[model samples]
Every structure is written in C-alpha cells, then in structure tokens.
Target chain A: MAQLLPSVWRHIPERYSLLGSHCENCGKDYFPQRPICPTCRRKGKIVQKLMPREGKIFSHTLVHAAPAGFELEAPYHLAIVELKNGVHLLSQIVDSDSEAIQINSPVKMVFRKISEDGKQGAIAYGYKFKVVRNAAAASKPGKPVGKQSTSSKK
Target chain B: MNRSGIVGYGTSVPRMRIKVGEIAKVWGKDGERVSSGLGIIEKSVPALDEDSATLAVEAARVAVEAGKINPQKIGAVFVGSESKPYAVKPTATVVAQAVGASVHMTAADLEFACKAGTAAIQACMGMVASGMIEYGLAIGSDTAQGKPGDALEYSAGGGAAAYVIGKPAESIAVIEDTYSFTTDTPDFWRRQHEEFPEHGGRFTAEPAYFKHVVSATRGLLEKTGMKIGDFDFVVFHQPNGKFPGRAAKILGVPDEKIKQGLITPILGNTYSASSMVGLASVLDVAKAGERILMTSYGSGAGSDSFWFTVTDKIEEEGRRQPESVFEMLKDKVNVDYATYAKHRRKIKSL
Candidate 1:
C-alpha cells in the first residue's frame, strides 16, 4: 500500500505577494525584495513595492524536453508574462497550447509547488501565473477544479 | 591591472546530436530543407531530467577539478543564463550546494539575453577585487530552444563554462578595466515569460551586434588608452560566426584576434557565455605575458568589454579533470532530426 507522508500545509498569507523594491531615484524594480536600490547605488531609501498577479502572456514555449521526473508532462508551456503593474516575469502556462499563447493573453497569479529539493526532501512553493478566463467561465454553473477564492487580494 | 582571468573552465554538450538529414525526413522533404533559414545542422538536447542548472553544475565541477583551492572555500556562485529552469526559483542555490561551496555566500542568477555570463563575471570580479572572499565561481549555461526552423535554432546549443575568480598570484589572468553602454531598444527580446524570442534580424544585426559592441569596445580602449594592436587576442559574443567577423573588421581588431573564439562553427551560439567560454579556450594555450580583450553583446542593446592579462599561474593548473575544455568538445554523440524533434518535443498533434 502507498503511504502518505506527514504533511504540513499552511496558507502563505492571504495578502501573499512577491515583494520588490523600486528605486524612487531610478525607477528600477528589484524582485524578492532588496533593501537597497541597485541602480541608484542608494542606501535604504527605495519604496516598498507590490506587483499584481493579473497580466498577459508576453511570449511562451512548449517545453517538449521535460525536466527530470516530468517526462509525462512534456510539451508543457512556459511563458514570459507581463503583470499589470509593469513587472515582467517567466512562468508555466496551465491548461493551454503553446501556439495559442499570444503576446497579450490575460493571466492571474496563483501558487504551486515548483520542485523538491534534491537533498533534505524539502518541497519548495512559490507564486506563479496562469491564464485568466473570460466572464463566461466565471459564471458557469458548476465549480471548477483548482479555483481559489479571490477574497484575500494582495 | 588585477588578474581576473579564467582559472578553471568546463562545458556540457548533450550526449545526442541530431543532423539536418533527419529533420528533412520528418518533414517529408526529399532533400535540402531550408530548416527555416537558419544554417543549424543539428542541436544538443538534454535528457528529461537535465536542465541549465544541472548543466551549470557539471561545467563547474570540471572547472574546479584542477583548481588549487578547496571547493568549500568558494565565496560566491553566480549563474548566467537566459533559459533558466524556473522563473522565480534561484538555481544558484542548488548549483552552490552541488559544487560544495560555502553556505555563507552570495548566490544569484543573471539574464541579459546572451550577455548574462560576462555580467556574472563582472559581478564576481567586483567581489574578488574588494577582497570580500578568496574565490568566486561564475557560470554561463543555457538550454535555449528555438521554435522549429526559426532563425535562432541553428545557432542555439546547450552548453556551459565556469571561471574561478581569485587572487592574482593564483589567478591565471587578471581582469583589467570593463566598459559598458546601454540603450532601450527591442531589436531582439523575450518578454516576461516568453518561450520563443522575437527579433528584427536586420535590426538585431546592426544595433545589437554592430553598434553596441563597436561602441563599448572603442569606449573601453579609449578609457584604457590601449590600441587594438596591444591585445594578443579578442573574443566577442557569437550570435553567429559571421557577426563577430563583421564586428571585428569594423572595430580594427585583426582576423586572428577574432579567430580565437570560433567554437560556434561547431557548437552554435551559447547565449550569455559565448564570449567568455571562448576566452577560456584562448586561456588554455595562452602564455604568461599575453593580453586578451573580450567584448559581449546582449539583446535590448547593451555591451560589456573587459581587459585580461595572462600569468604564469596557468602552467601550475595542468589538466586534472575528466573533461578538459579540449577533451569535452572532441567526444561525439549524435541524434537524428526526429530524435531532435522528439528531444525538443517539437511535434504537434493534429
């Protein structure tokens, strides 16, 4: 019989965000948060910044050569997305085709497991974006899988 | 000038190589398929589990094999790549751990189209020059895949190179001055999360390759007040063999100076590490008194040029690795076009 490992599931803040620091002096943004602005070579005066999850696919590719342990998931799409706040990012595209992914396909932020640490067995979790559906999909009669409530907006 | 030359070097070419004839067969063409106007005969594909980060680790492993210091003393690990395995995930941590670097160190990834490798070196050199650490490792590796038959595919290959930055006494070469120029232009760019990059070829050729590289190299020479003739060698980013040749002529650098880094004729363009890896090759046979000038260009219109002076330390670090830069390139592994498509996962269901 397959055994389930003990798991510690926790919500990573309702206002979860990928915080960055935008130099008030030069307007360049640093991701994963930086104390000092790199461009201005300034010390400690940059403003706290938060970029939204919603945006569009600026470009994308189907990863036919899947990473190790992801062979079955070959041809999965990876995208470069631009968020509404003008932040550009790279992410995986869920439930879509590589060809159909265009320059401006709308997307929304979500959280998913990226990879397991090769050693120590720690699982890493991070925020990513997926395609945003139309009003029709939102108003559908049945609840869809993988849908999370948007009440805890960042 | 402080010596920041390559102390160690390594590369990763896929076990399998796919040929043009095989690609022609899959498309059901009798012969001579244009392959989308890119003159790529084949490409190296990673196994299902391999990625840029893993390849970077392999390259670094080879580079450090003959190096004098213990791996545990490495103060920083920097990876320069455009096709990183994860968007938000920093591959440097994994690479650092894999290479047995000190836990307390700076680790990060850099991306500037293909110039990511040299940028990582510049950052490492800054730390080394500051005497913050005894040694720093910089790697440029990529598994950049071009859309089927696109212009970029033929020239894009999977590869990596590593350099250990340390004190001049133990260093093979010391880094001199570095100069860079930047402009906001979209000659060639991959948007935030894009897979395939977009380019205006003529525009990319002129501005991204010609204009910026010329300006930056001239700017560096002007700042240092050194003539092109003073350098024993020159290495430029290899978007294609032709681009560097053209740029070399335009900049008054000699043909032999440009010839030192033509691995692209066999391996294709390796984004960020293209020029630095070539410099590593030049360092393999360079004498203690030689001088090298390196120039790198990235998309979005930016260029970095730096000076290097070879030292006697190169003689002390003889071959002690499984795959020295020369040995790695000499081995063979080939795959057909169908396998290339299968490896790249290019087939689409109708």
Candidate 2:
C-alpha cells in the first residue's frame, strides 16, 4: 500500500488517456511514452501522442489460473491489441464472451477498474477492450440491435 | 443569456442489467406488482470495475468526439454525482485528465441529489455565455445506492450523461431559456457515512419531485412565454418511471411529446443522470427547428428547467460513434440476482 500511490500516479497518463510518444522521423508510435526515440536517439523528434481507442486483436490467451488480486476475474481473456495506429499493447478483454473474441477481432477501449490494492486500499483503473462484433450493424440507422450474440456478423 | 448552447451531448448506461423479476424472486415478492408500481422493467448495474468517474469519462469522450473541438480549448470540467468513488477527491479532475482536457482548466465535483447534473450544466452555461471560456464540459453520473431489499433498489440505477457547452454558432441546439426553483425540502437524504439513502416514501413525490419539477417547468414556460404545445418534446427527472409521465400530464403536455424522453421505464433511475440522459435520447432523433423542454429534480431538493431549439448541426453530430442512448439500452446483458449482488458489491465478505 505504501508504494501504491507513486506507481498509480506514474501510470496515470498512459493508463487514463492512452498517452504515448511518437517518433516523427520514422512515424512510429510507442505506448508508455518513451522519452527518446530508439531509432534516431538524440536526433529523434518525439512528441506526446494519444492513440486511437479503436483497434483489433493481434493475439490473445485465456488465463484460467487467477493472479493475485485478480481472483474474482479469473478465467478472463487477455489479448495483445494492435491499435489503428499500429501500436500494440496488452490488455484484458471484457463485456463479451470468450468465444466472440478471435484473431483480428475489431475492438474498442473502455475505462474500467483494473484492481484494488487491498480490502480498504485505493482502486486502480485502466483501459480494457470490448469486441465490436458487428461494426456495420452498429452503424446502421434506426433502432439499436438488441443483444449482441456471438453468432452475429457485420 | 449570452447565446451559449449545447455543442455536443453523449450518454452511457452500464451494459449489465437486473430485471425487476430477479430482485422480486429473491425477496419473495410479487414481481408484477413491484414492476407495475414502479413502472420499471430493469435497471443497469455497474460492473465491479465501473463507477461514476469511469461512466463520466466514457460519456465525456463521446461528447468531445462529437463536438470535434480541441481538448486544450476546454476551460472547465464539472462532474455531478451522488456516488463519487472518493469522499475527499474531486471526480472532475479525474474526468478532465482522462478526457485529455487542458491542464489549466477549472474542475470541481458537485452534489445536489439527482439534479446535481443539471446544476453543472447551469454553471457551464454561465461560463460559456459570459465568454469566460471557449468550451465547458458538464457531466452527471452515478452508481446510485439502495438498501438491500428496499424499494429504492428496484429503481436505483447506474449511468452518465455529458454535454459540451459553447458559443451558439457552434451548437447543435441553442439554449432559448433556463430557470430554477429551490427550497429546503428534505424529501430524501443520505447522512454522512451512510451506505444508502432514506426517503420520505410517498413524500418523495408530492412536495419534492413533482413540486420542484412542475414549478421549474412552469417558471421556464412563463418566463420564456412558451406554452406546453410550443415545445416538440418534454423531459422530466425520472426517479421512477411513473413520475415523469405524471408530470407531463400535470403540465398539459401530451403523452406523445413525452414518450421519446421516457427512458426511465427501461433504464431505471440513474439519479443525477436521469433527466440529462432522457434529454440526450430526445436529441438523438430530433429534427432541425424543433424545440425541447427539460426539467430535473433533486431530493433535498430543487429543480432546474431549460428550453432548447435544435439546429441542423444536430443531424451530423448526433450520428457519431459509441451509439445513442437507445442503442445502449437495446444492447444489454441481463444478470441474475447473485451476479447483481456481486457486481453491486452488496455481498460482504468477513
């Protein structure tokens, strides 16, 4: 609990807003906002960038074994998502069934509670991905499509 | 008023829902009776990870995207909620940072029971209308609390709504007029450190919800010289499904005019977000040149009323992604009583 405050504060920018660094020279984006671009070293033009929340699953794995502090959410799906800007990051997939998540599945970012420090400690929040099963269906005008079934197609 | 209006608006309801029957089953009460009495079918329940702050951020992000404004230009952020996660910290700062608003922006948290969200809106209108800010974001969100097996549990819900207020030229709907009515009516309250609020039962309606809402609406109409029939739509704060419908009849507004904004029957009462979300739902499908009347009530208690005229810009801005309130309501996942209890943190572990 003592170290929780600093760690939480340090990750605020990246966790909350997906703040990252962009290397103008190579046009590459990096999450966690690196201070210096590896390609150009001191000559690199690095600036703060906000990655688009929309993305697709690059790779994913199901974690049946629970990690400490994540016991209640055990058997959850963890995925490596590649943002529209081509930056990849690891995050937990939520608000959908495991069967609905596939390689290259379209996804969107959502802020959610990641974990709690203790029974009476501070709660940590960060980004998670939810599968957008039918992008086309969601865009259509008129009434909203009720209940997103795993079988629905865009 | 200095020609300020709503540049953009967005709403969010938690995906998880618990039907009236589920709660009824656990308490061994007649589901149909409770459902009929409250006029609510289901209520959104936040996931273990979701709270007022998160809901506010989601709604604010959608509003920002719709407005197509630079986050750096926003001058203020106000979040109104009865369920702010922290007692000491301001939820507005977290919302401002999460939405990438400028660091120099003013931020604060507000509480006025259910009407707190509209109070934030009134504040933003003042700042924007005075030319003191380029744009201001006002948000109302809540994970409303109700005691275990209490009547409040059936209607208390979780959700949020956000609005971006700016110059009239950039607005989707121009603010025609606004009014407020306040008093020391204690129809409902939650004491310090109390887990849930206590209400005066039927007293919550007569002298509190209905009284404030009716007075505010009448005041706005009388001040603006607009009759009930002049408005295209009407929205009232929905503590329960029945109150808004009743208020509409009392104000001489037809049922058809209020139907579009009557979302409480399905989404339950989102406390601070109730009326705001209903207004957003109405705006989603409203056409250019139409007028909207809105009134919000907060137990403790008071009401705020506003009149808006939709512009052509609403057609374009209302179609943006993240979907509308209707879409969010349709796309829901139902959970049983056990899951609801777990999600709501109602089940305690020693």
Candidate 3:
C-alpha cells in the first residue's frame, strides 16, 4: 500500500503537526527547521518536531495577485500564526470569511489544500487557522434563531 | 590587478532521470523527435523540494571546497536566475545561509533572462575591481520549467554554477575587457511571478542569438585590439547546441573551438546559467596565456563580451579541485520521462 504512494506518506505526519525546529546549541525555536542555528551559527544541531497547532493570527493579508501556480486561488488570506512555542508560521487562513479575521483573534490549525500547478501534484492538507464565530449574534430575545438543532426534532 | 577567480565549484542535480522515449510515449511523439528537434536526449529535473536557491547552495558548496577562501571573508553573494522561488524575497539571502556565507556580506538577486549569470559575474568583477570587498561569489542557477509537451520542455533542465571572483593575480582567470550591446526588444520575456516563459521563437533565433552574438563578439575583439584568430576558444550562451554552432559559423570561430566543453548536450538550457557553466567547463581546459573570448546574451535583448587570458596561478588551483569536467559527466545517472515529470512536479491530477 505504501509503495504505490511514497510522497503522500511523507506528508501524513505534516497534516496535524504544527512543525517547528529546536536549536540544540542555543535552545532557540524556529517555526521551520533552519539549516543552521541562527543564534549560534552552529551547523547540524537543529532538530525537527511538532509545534502547537493553536494560535492567534499575528497579521494577515489578502493576496489579489498570486503567482502563476497560485492564480486561481487568489483572494485567499495569508496569516502569520504565533504558536505557543514562540515560533511564528506563515500560513493560509481557511474556512472563515476574510472579514472576520482580525489581529490577535484565536484560531486553530486545520488541514486544507493550498494550490496545485495542475501539472505538478497538488500540495495536499497543510495547516490553516480559522476564527471561531461568536454565538451571541445567533440568539436574541425576540428570535430564538440559534435553535436550528432544536427545530431538527420536527 | 587583484586576482579574482574561481576558488572552488560545486553542482547538484536531481537523482531522478527522464528519457526521450518516455516523453515520446506520453506526448504521442517520437523519441527521435525530441532528441533531434530540441537537441536534448535527457534533462536533469529538480524534486518538489528543490528550487533555484537550493540548487545554488549545492553548486556553491563545490566552489568552496575547491578553494582555501574563508567563508567569513566573502563580502558578497549574488544569485542570478529568472526562476527565483519567491517574488518579494531575495533568493540570495536563503542561498547565502544555505552555503554558510558570511552574514554581513551583501546578498541580492539579478535578472536578465539567460544572460543573468554572466551579468552577476560582471557585477562581482566591478565590486572586486573597485576594492569594495575582498572576495565575492556569483552564482547562476535555475530550475527552469517548460510547459508540458511544449518545445521548450525538452531543453529546459535544473542546474547551477558558482564562481568566486577576487584579485586577478590571485585568481584563476582575470577579466581583461567587457563589451555590451543592448537594445529594447522582447524576443522572449516572463512577467513577474510567472512560471512559464513566452517567446517569439524565430525572431529570437535570428536577432537575439545570431545578430547579438556576432555584434558583441566583434565589439569585444575591436575594443580589445584582438581578432578571432588570436583566441584559443569561444563560449556563448547555449539555448541549444545547434544555435551556438550556427552562431559560431557566422562569426568564423570554427566548429572545433566552439564545440569544445559546450554543456547543453547534457545539462540542457539552464537559462541564465547556460553560458557560464560552459565557461567553467572551458576554464578546465584553458592554459595560461591562452586567450578566451566569451559572449553572453539574454532574451530580452542584451549581450556582454569579455576577453580573458588564463594565468599560471589558476592552472595550479585547478589541480586542487575535483576531477575534470569529463569525470563529473561520467558520474551522472540518467532517468526516464515519467521520473522527470515527478522530479519537476509536473504531473498532478489527483
């Protein structure tokens, strides 16, 4: 089963892991495993492991003009996710409208497709964050509109 | 006169190989068609993880290994490629970090289509000549992607070459004279952040390759007070083997002198890196006091010609490096077309 798809298997662990690299020499953490330790200039001591999947959006931008490979996926939000480990990751914000995304908004990582060159294999299932919607707006005194689940009994 | 030359050199190519028959099968074309029409039998492709930056790092490592130059002493690193990984970011910074160049050195990217590699070398020469820095590294590398089944795909491949330029006396090859011919014409162009390049094929064949190369070569010869007969060798930007040969015949450079050490037959059209890689191969065979006339052209319409005479100092430095260019070519492993697609990540339906 695994022999048929080798690259797919390599990416399975990346699906859920908020991956980051820890510098063995300086004890510094980087969102992506750096080839060298920036603090120490030491080589070969940086090790890779999982990072926190939940964080707040530090900053974001809506890209209107993407590269040739990402043209069709335009108008998507790209955000800098600040994880608990002090490592910042640049990722796409998905499953939520761009209007709701604000600085410092709490978000959780979810798997989503970035884009495919169509000729190259699609970059499958990478990390993205979503802002949890507020519940108070759905329920009001005059209208119990949040009761969609309750009405399901009919 | 400061000696600025290649102290070391390195190269990296994808392990996977793609053959002509495989491409012919997929595209419903004949294997002979790709090999004969495009002048490429096989091309080295980069894996999904490999980009221009990574390939430059691979080449820079080889350059460093061939010399006694200190990493911290390197005052600048320049990467020239049309296929940079990011639009806003500087690829030189990533490549510098990858090869462990000094953090304080100036790092930047240069673009001039295929002529960019030689352009970077000219820039390095300027900096070294001015005494702004002690040593600088100029790299020309690319992971050029041609559209599937397009005529370009057959000749586009992934590779890189790095040269360390410094004082000429201490260098391998000293820059003698440089001549440039520039015009505003779009023979071929790729817009910002574009994956595929657009071209006016027949126009480029005439005006871009033949017209510019002859003019630039003649310009350098006249300026340097030397003629075609004085040079032991000539190197030109090679989009394909046939084009350079045709240009050579037009310039009266002779088939034997022009064909020696030409790399497109194996490495494919590396865009900006093509001519410089060929130059590096020529340097391997060039002797002290032997004159070399090199002409470089970019697709947007620009060419630079330089005259150089090898020094005895470089001949000694050559021995400290890897086995000759021929050995490296023998060490390579060839692959088929499907693997090429996978390496370049060109097949993605699921």
Candidate 4:
C-alpha cells in the first residue's frame, strides 16, 4: 500500500490529462512524457503536449486471466491505441464488448478505476480507452458529436 | 439575480441495472407491488470498482468538453455525495485533476443527503456571480447504499451529474434566481459506522421532503415574482417515481412540464444526483427562451430551488456530447438478484 502511493502520484499528469512530450527537432510526440527524445538525444528539445483523446485501436488482446487484483474484470479487452498525433498508448478498453474490438476501431479516452489495493486501500484511477462504434459520425471534421445533445433530443 | 448561469451540463449512469422484480424475487415480496410502490422499474448498480468519484469524473469530463473552455481556467470544483470512496479525502480534488482543471483551484466535498448536489451548485453560482472565478464546476454523484431486504434496496441507485457555471454571456442557460429553505428535520440519517441509512419512512414525506421542496419553490417564485405558468418546465427531487409528480401537482405544474425530468422510474433515486440528473435531462431537450424551475430536497432536511432560462447557445452546446441520459438509460445490461448482490459486494465469502 505504501509503495502504490508514489507510483500513482508519479503518473498523475500523464494518466489524468494525457500529458506527453514532443520533440521539436523530429516533430514526433512521445506519451508518458519522456524526458529526452531517443532519436535526437543531446539535441532534442522536448516540450510538454496534451494528446488528443480520440484515437483508433492499433492492436488488442483478450485477457482471460487478469493479474492480481483484476480477477473481477477477467475476459476484458486490452488495446494499444494510436492517437491522432501518432502516439501509441497501452490501455484497457472498457464499456465495450470484447467480441467487437478490432484493429483500427475508433476509441475515446475515459476516466475509470484502474484498480484498488485492498478493501481499505486507496483506489487507483486513470484513463482507459473505450471503443466508439459510430466512428464516421463521431469523427466528423469540424463538429463535436456525442458531446452535444442527449439521445432523445437528437 | 446576477449574470451567472450553467455553461454546460452532463450526466453519467452505470450500465448495469437490476429490475425491481429481480430484487423482489429474492425477498419473497410481490414484484408488482414493490415496483408500483416505488414507481421504479429498475435501478442502476455500479460495478464493484465504480464509485462516486469515478462517476463524477466521467460526468465532469463530458461537461468540460461540452463547454469548450480551457480546463485550466476552471477555478473551483465541488462534489456532493454521501458515498464518497474515501471518508477523509476530498472527491472534488480527484475530479478536478481528472477533468484537467488547473492546479490552483478551490475544491471540497459536500453532503446534504439528496440535495447535496444542488448545494454545490448554489456555491458555484455565488462564486461565478461574484466574479471570484472564471468558471466553477458543481457535481452531484453517488453510489447509494441499501441494506438487504430494506425498502431502500428497491430504489437506491448509482449515477452522477455535473454542471459548469460561469458568466451568463458564456452560458447555455441563464440563472434567473436561486433560493434555499432549511430546518433541523432528521427524517433520515446514516451514522459513521452504519452501512445503510435510516429513514423515518412515512415521516420523510410530508414534513421533510414536501415541506422543504414546496417552501423553496414557492420562495423562489415569490422572490423572483415569477408565476408557475411562466416556467416551461419544472423538476423536483425524486426519491421515488411518485414523489416528484406529487410535488408538481401540489405546486400546480402540469404533468407534461415535469414528465421529461421524471426519470426516477427507470434510473431510481440516485440520492445526491437525483434532481440534478433530472435537470440535466430537461436541459437536453429544452429550447431557447424556455424557462425551467428546479427544486431539490435532501433528507435531514432541506431544499434548494433555482430558476433558469435556456439560451440559444444550448442548441449548439447540447450537441457536443455523443451520449445523453436517455441513451445511457436505454443502453444497459440487466442483472438478476444474485448477480446484483455480487456486483454490489453484498455477499461476503471470506
């Protein structure tokens, strides 16, 4: 429980807000906020950036036997999502049907409970990706879709 | 009345639901009787991992996105809930961090039974109206508790609603007036170590819920000099599907005016989120120039009432989110009583 606190604190900026870093020289973005761009090494000018929340699944797998503390969520889908900025994020896919996930499936970031230490320990929360079925209508160029009106109204 | 109002609003309800029939079957009660008595068909049950904070973050994310403002500009965040995951920590700070609000901000958790959410709204209204902050967020969320075979087990639900309050010029709905009525009425309460709340049953209705709600509504109307007919819609705190309707009738509001917000039949009473979620549902379809009156009652007990006028910006802002309360309601997976127990962690097998 003591060790979990610092780990949760260290990842807050990246986990909560998708804070990443971009290399000024190579025009490439790195998630998890790398302090130095591997490609540029000494010359890299890294600046903090917030990646777009919308992305597409680059790959995925079914986790039938989840690790310790994740037994309740067995058979959940885990995916590597590539945001529009070309940065890949390894995240658990939630609020979705496992059978429906496919390569290139559009996804969106959502805040969800990642895990809990115990019955009384601190519950860790962060970002998870969820499959967005209506990619076409949702990914329209200028307008935001699901964010606007409630279902009955539209 | 100051120039402060709701910039954006959003609601989140868990996908899992347990039917009243399912609950009644386990207790050997008449499912039909239980359903009719509570005016609830089903109630949302949070996943074993989900709680008030997660629900608040989800709702607040949608609200912040819909508002289309820099999250860094939000100066305050308040979360109202009786089921906060941590008894010691502030749920508001977690919500603020999740929503990407700036580090320099004021935040706190509030509790006032079901009306706690509206209390948060009142605080945000005051801050925005006073120009103390550029944007303030008020959220009501809960994973309400109900002991096994208890009457509350039929209606206690899980959900959340978040509102972004700011200057009227940047708002989708403009605040006309707000009022609160309170008294030392302990119609319901949960002690520090108690898992489920205790209620006065029949006593909760007349003196606690109805009295405060009616008083707050009438007080707002009188203070604002607005007639019942002047408002296009009305929303009342829903402990059951019947309470809001009964309160509306007593206040002379037409059934149609309250119908859109009367979602308790399907969502159950989400405790702190009940009336705020109803108001969000109403705002989803309300048109420009439409006036809405909302009054919320919390056990222990008190009420807060607000008058709002929908602005033209609502047409655009309302379309920003892909999901709505109605969609969340329609999209659900039903669980039987045993599964409900497993999800709610009622069956301890240690």
**Best prediction by DockQ:** 4
Give the range of the ten consecutive residues with the poorest summed lDDT in model 1 chain B. Answer: B319-328
lDDT of 3 by residue, B1-350 (tens): 44355555545444334655566777888888768776666766665545677667656756765656776778888999988766667778756654556678898899988888778878888888889988788888888878888777777877787887777766667778788888877898887666688889788888777788888899988887787877777888888768888778888877667665477777778887887777767766666677777888898888888877777765563333354443444434566666566656676741
TM-score, one value per model: 0.67, 0.95, 0.68, 0.94
Evaluate fnat for each of the predicted models and list the values in order.
0.00, 0.25, 0.00, 0.22
Best first by lDDT, ranked: 2, 4, 3, 1
Off by over 4 Å in 3: A1-154, B1-8, B317-320
B23 Cα displacement, candidate 4 (Å): 0.9
What would the per-residue lDDT of candidate 2 be over residues A20-82, giving only the tens digit for each residue?
999998888999789999989988999999899999999999998978877777778999999
True A-B contacts kept by model 4: 0.22
Report the lDDT tens digits of candidate 3 across residue range A1-154. Answer: 2342466435544443445677787778876556777778845488887777667888989999977655544667889978867678888775455677889887766434443334334323345666644434211111111111111110
Q: Across residues B1-350, which tens digit of lDDT does each residue of candidate 4 receive?
A: 57798988888988789999899999999999999988999999998668999899989988888888888999999999999899899999999988888888899999999988999999999998898999999999999999899899999999999999999988889988898999999999999977789899899999989999999999999998888888877899999999888898899987878877888899989999999988888777777888889999999889999999988988773433546567557667788888789878888771
User: What DockQ does model 1 achieve?
Assistant: 0.01
Q: Candidate 1 regions off by >4 Å?
A: A1-154, B1-5, B20-42, B317-326, B348-350
Error of 1 at B9 (Å): 2.7
lDDT digits (tens) for residues B1-350 of candidate 2: 57788998888878899999899989999999999999999999998889999999989988888888888899999999999888878889888988888898899999999989999999999999898999999999999999988999999999999999998898989987899999999989999988899999989888988889999999998998878878878889998889988998899887777777878889989999999998988877777788889999999989999999988887783444357677767778899999889888898871
> lDDT at B59 for candidate 4?
92
Candidate 2 vs. truth: CA RMSD?
A: 5.2
| i-RMSD of all predictions | 28.4, 12.2, 35.0, 9.2
Better of 1 and 2 by DockQ: 2
